[model samples]
Target: MKVAIVGAGLTGSLLACFLARRGLTVTLYERRPDPRVAQVERGRSINLAISERGLNALRKIGLVDEVMADALPMKGRMIHPVTGALDFQAYSASGDRAINSISRGALNNALLTAAVAADGVSVEFEHRLVELDSAVGRMVFATPAGKVSVEADVVLGADGAGSAVREQLLAEGIVAENVDFLDYGYKELSIPAVDGEFALDPGALHIWPRGTSMMIALPNPDKSFTCTLFWPAGSFDALTSASGIEDHFRINYPDLLPLAPNLVDDYLNNPVGVLGTVHTLPWQAHGRTALLGDAAHAIVPFYGQGANCAFEDVVELDRCLDDTGGSWARALPLFEARRRENTEAIAEMALANFVEMRDKVASPVFRLQKQIEHTLERLLPGTYVSRYELVSFSTTPYAEVQHRVHRQHQLLGAAAVAAAGVLFAVTRSRARR
Candidate 1:
């Protein structure tokens, strides 16, 4: 089969590699210049947290070890409060499983290299997809050299949240999409290495949780940390002056102020990126074209599952093809049916985690609850698993994780009520005596 994949990004490049392994002739068309040669645009790059799901996909393609060589494993979240000492919350009950932090650009470049080296795969850079006819599997691209047209047996849209291929599908009225943009925006900043070493502990994902806004720092392979500030969309505009920026950090993120020497410059110059969730009615059209990754469903990054979920989509799609004996007609619908619910569940969880990270992570009650959850997980072993553990450390389907977590919470709530009632009865009996 001849496959054309739009967007040579992380998902698209990785997908190309997967299809190539299946003996399919695949061509990747990317609008942007090759990431291996171009400098990354500032302020927009968010580091990815690669967990089991992402690694599982890479393992299948024999790229897991290569990718993890540059990744740093973060075992837990290090909560930096406004005052007092720092608190740590391990992601897994056993405290051994961790999510790997890897640069988005680096991972993309690695995948692109693999895709290029894979047999039966070719990549065309600077090919901006301008037209796509899913019904006939024909695509037109505007290149710097000139307009180029190609025909393929199958086309996949992994172009990301603002996918041009998806736009063409919308224009043709083949699919419906709904984008729910959060009022918040994020700006990326840097905390360079100090004395040739990391500025903070590289063992955890550092979070500065203010009530309404939050900042998170993930360690990079270069011994630096990529810090992102999530705030109200309009709030970034309020800090225009150097003093204003410094003062805001002093009051909200004091520890970060001294660590980031270029704070003022990064704050003022960096662009604030909008956060949103994209929901598409159907990810496939005419059984000849399909959407995957962020194009199909774009979720916020709070749960750190955006990239992981996209990787899982590639795995599931490959499995569908295996089941259908490489028939696109049977595989496309099966892929969508299998992924839609899981993606929806993760989208909802990611949004809810935003509130938990920015507001609840610093609360005493929230800490106590996490302790209890961890305790239960240890006591019950396989019977009890925290939502964070189920999502990050395991390959459990996202929809099933959501269902299991709900049931566990219900049981815990009932147990608590029963214990409270018994205590009240004992107190009443003592009073009567």
Candidate 2:
């Protein structure tokens, strides 16, 4: 089968490899020039935290080792509060398992290279999808040379949050999409290495959580850190002057100011990227064209599952083809049915995690709750698991993770009530005696 994939990004390129492995002819169309040849666009490349889910997907294609060659494993979150000593919260009870931090650009380049090397796969850089006819399997691209047209048996849209293929589907009335933009925005900054060594602890994902806004830094292979500030949409634009930027950091992130040498320049010059969730009805169209990854459902990055979830989409779609014996008609619908609920569940969880990361991570109550959760996980062993562990360390489906976490919370609440009742009865009986 001849397949055309829009957007030669992480998901699209990875999907090309999977399709090519099945002996299907695949071509990847990318709007942007090759990243291997060009510099990455500024203020947009957020470092990715690849967990078990993403790694499992790569393992399937035998690219896990290559993709993760430079990844740094972060065992826990290091909370940097405004007025006290730092606190570290381990993600797992045993404190051994960790999420790997890797650069988005680096990972994408690796996948693109793999895709190009795969048999029966071709990539066309600088070819933007201008029009797509799902019903007839026709596509037209606007390239530097001129207009280019291609025909395929199937087309898949993995073009990300602002997918042009999705726009064509919407315009042709084949699909409906709704985008929910967060009032908050994010800007990327840097924490260079100090004295040829990592300036901060490289084993943890560092977070400076303020009540309404927060900053997080992840370790890079170059002995530096990539810091992202999540703030109100208006807040980023409010600080126009150098003094204003410095004053804001001094008040909200004093320690960070010293660590980031180019704070003022980064803050003043870097663009603020919007954060949001994209929801679409029926991720596939006529079984000939379908959407995956951010094109199908784009969730915020709070849970660090944006890329991981996209990788999972590719794996699941590939599995659907296996189940259906490589019939696109059977596989596309099945893929959408299998993924919709899980994607929605992850979307909600990611939003809730934003609150936890920015506001609750430093709270005493939240810390106590985490400690209790870890204790229960240890005591119950297989019977209990924290939500973080389930999401980051296991291959459990997102919907199942949500269900299990809810049930666990209910059981814990009931046990607390029973313990209180027993204490009350003992006190009353002793007083009467």
Per-candidate TM equals 0.98, 0.99
Model 1, range 73-100, lDDT digits (tens) per residue?
Answer: 9999999987789999888878888999
lDDT of 2 by residue, 269-364 (tens): 899999899999988888889999999999999999988999999999999999999899999999999999999999999999999999999999
CA lDDT of each candidate? 0.94, 0.93
Which ranges of candidate 1 are over 4 A from the true structure?
none
Model 2 steric clash pairs: none
State in Å the error of residue 255, model 1: 0.8
TM-score of 2: 0.99
Location of the lowest summed lDDT over 10 successive residues in candidate 1: 39-48
